[model samples]
Target: MYIPFDEMVDTSRVWIYQADKQLSTAEQSQIESKCNSFLQEWAAHGQALKSSFQIIHDKFLVISVDESFNQASGCSIDASVALVKNLEQELGINFFDRTKICFLVNGEIVEIPLNGIKSEVKNGNIKSDTLTFNNLVSDIRSFQTDWKVEAKNSWLKRYFQ
Candidate 1:
């Protein structure tokens, strides 16, 4: 998305929790270790999938295989999605929110509030990136659409090439 940095409506920022205040040394160490292990496993799975199939875009990936291969692999998209969701919950980071197009200006990262952004997921336009948000909504609407389409198409071609 071609989000102009000036048009970003920063809503709220998250507060970082102090390590000493939130967790004990042992507990924090355990959490960190578990998180690292989870990340390693997640990366390994993603690498395996990428090596096996063709990735189209950030949101959509497809693997073309015959019945024999499909049966032999038995890869479940639902399970993958569930695992991602669980990982996000454990890590306290939203993957979809991170996918937003950010505009950098003067060494600062600007973000648009997703509160009023109308998602097109309800409709059949899953490929559309035209987000409708409050305040300068029209200006930023086409920004996301153009960028997403171009990036996805470029990535797909590059992957195939």
Candidate 2:
């Protein structure tokens, strides 16, 4: 789950493992360490200086950071993109791809198009504003239950689970 660094508000946590599994202490510690390292590397990114983080358990972690960085400073889009690129590099995951992910902003559905140049907002207009990864994660978590049910009922459920 990728939360934009800028929209991070209150600390957030999520489970990284299934509850049914009984992990050995070593395995659990390894997962925790990986999660911690993930957050640390994220915070170490150029635009992530003001961010703070903590790992609660093998399953959950919290990230607390200033939201002021949401604002782009002039023509520093390179800096902004660099932050994302660094995250992708560190995570070995593409966090900024819109094709596989969708965002709901203030009730509007926004999708990162195939081209990745801009997002297409559905059911509402797109506002000219920067959105943080934290905010997106929060929103998704809030609607997670509903999404889970919906996914289970759809053909995509096999792929998701």
Candidate 3:
């Protein structure tokens, strides 16, 4: 069920899991292996799901699935959640933590608490031109194009306004 990510086309469904902190090299290797192993057996109601995953910037885990063959069912999704929970416990990494706001400062991804964003912007650490990761992208096309975009164009627009 695991396919080459590049060959999977741009219509695939995507899921992004952000780590609270960057993963170590060893942890990345182990996590990659675990993800590959999981994809090999991942299924949707007995139908194999064509899936692939990759680690980006040593932190974000991007999982894409070509659901053109079989849709991911409730059971399969729950299984994935369970897998992530197990990974969190085993690796001491929290993939479900969304409290940290991720953005680009001088081309580096910076994490800050949401409440502190205003201060960073006010202090000129983050400007109107700052690029932020729009991790809410739902498809491969958007993931490719809009994953990292200007803060003004993202859900943080209200803050900028």
Candidate 4:
């Protein structure tokens, strides 16, 4: 069954999908409804999966699952992918694009194309202290930690030289 995000354990599994662009208010509401409905019936091995989701930065879709109850099976994971595909079709939002990277500069969010990471840093657009989002985080615990990191201390560090 769906639970509030804050109620889920810190170790809950998480999946972060960042949109290529910020979503409109209407789009956010629609996506929220879709996520809620999906989580309400989300189950694993016929057992109701305790899950929740939230939107962050008006550009990210964060889904969490408390696997302490029942681990999500391959089929359930496929179902979640299907939901994202349908939502992408319906909203024209691209959730699978990994070339877009996000970070914070001057207390604001900035997006840099991954393909141009080298130039972005070489030109001083991305700095060492910039909080870059490492969307590769696999669980809530990691999401809370590695989801954001200093560019110089992360994969982006290579570009600095």
Per-candidate alpha-carbon RMSD to the true structure: 16.7, 13.3, 1.0, 1.1
- Badly placed stretches (over 4 Å) of model 2 are 1-25, 43-45, 49-139, 150-152, 156-161
Q: For model 3, how does the per-residue alpha-carbon lDDT over 15-104 read when each residue is reduced to its tens digit?
A: 899999989999998888888999999999799999888889887998888888678888988887787788899999999888888887
Candidate 1 lDDT trough over 10 residues, lowest sum = 12-21
Task: Using TM-score, rank the candidates from best to worst.
Answer: 3, 4, 2, 1
Q: Give candidate 2's total backbone clashes.
A: 8
lDDT of 4 by residue, 52-150 (tens): 999998889998899998899899988888887888999999999987889888877788887887787779888887789888788888888788899
- Each prediction's whole-model lDDT (CA): 0.29, 0.36, 0.87, 0.87
Q: Over the stretch 52-86, how does candidate 1's per-residue lDDT look in tens digits?
A: 21111222121221222122132434443454455
Backbone clash count, each prediction separately? 0, 8, 0, 0
How much does candidate 2 score in TM-score? 0.28
Task: Give all TM-scores, in the order shown.
Answer: 0.27, 0.28, 0.96, 0.95
Better of 1 and 2 by lDDT: 2
Stretches of model 1 off by over 4 angstroms after superposition:
1-48, 52-75, 98-101, 114-161
Candidate 2 on 1-161: residue-level lDDT in tens? 23453455543322121111223466445544654455444432345434433332232233443445432233333433454355345544443443443333564333444344232323223333423122234322432333222322333234323
After superposition of all CA atoms, the RMSD between model 2 and the true structure is: 13.3
